[model samples]
Target: MVTIEPIMIKGHFFTAVTVCLPKTTLLTISNNTGYIMCGALDVGLLNSRLVDRKIIAGRAVGVKTIDELLMAPLESVTYEAEQHGIFSGMTGVEALLQMVG
Candidate 1:
């Protein structure tokens, strides 16, 4: 079993440092606002969700993961306008880490 700890440091961009114990793995994920991306995303999964170019930010820094972010606690941010939480359990992202790192 894996434990999930979602943390939020900024809002302009959503950043999370996911730590997996027992396995002793760590991932630093930075994604745009609702416009998000990560270093731990899946190419195939992202390709499957090919949306619009305008919707996807060009400043994607990390790898693309099929895993969706686990929603960070509302207390993590002040953006009430956003419906989708910034951070959450990213099953896909975590799996990618397991495979890659």
Candidate 2:
């Protein structure tokens, strides 16, 4: 199953998506500029192999829901995310604010 919904954070609008597979789920919250995702995201690949894309994204591990993902500290972030002041250990909400601020 797949679910997509609008989310409001500090008056900013974003999109939250949830994908349910056989035994695992994929979760992500995104705005126009960037996004934060669950462990399924590959921060390393975004930083290395796809560096040119300048994708601003972060990954949080052990999160089972979109709310957990938003509250959990990031395990890793893309280099482009770093450039935007988003870092590992920053909560998803904080990183998201930085993406728009």
Winning model by TM-score: 2
Report the alpha-carbon TM-score of model 1 versus the true structure: 0.26
TM-score of each candidate structure, all chains considered together: 0.26, 0.98
Model 2 regions more than 4 Å off: none
Task: Show how many residue pairs clash in every candidate, following the order shown.
Answer: 16, 0
Which stretch of 10 consecutive residues in model 2 shows the poorest summed lDDT?
92-101
**For model 2, which pairs clash?**
none
lDDT of 2 by residue, 1-101 (tens): 99999988999999999999999999999999999999999988998999999999999999999999989999999999999999999999999999889
Error of 1 at 84 (Å): 20
Off by over 4 Å in 1: 1-13, 24-28, 31-40, 49-101
Residue-by-residue lDDT tens digits, candidate 1, 1-101 = 33333443332324455555473343434444233334333333333454332222211222322133332211121122122322223232332232222
Please report, in order, the local distance difference test score of every candidate based on alpha carbons.
Answer: 0.31, 0.95
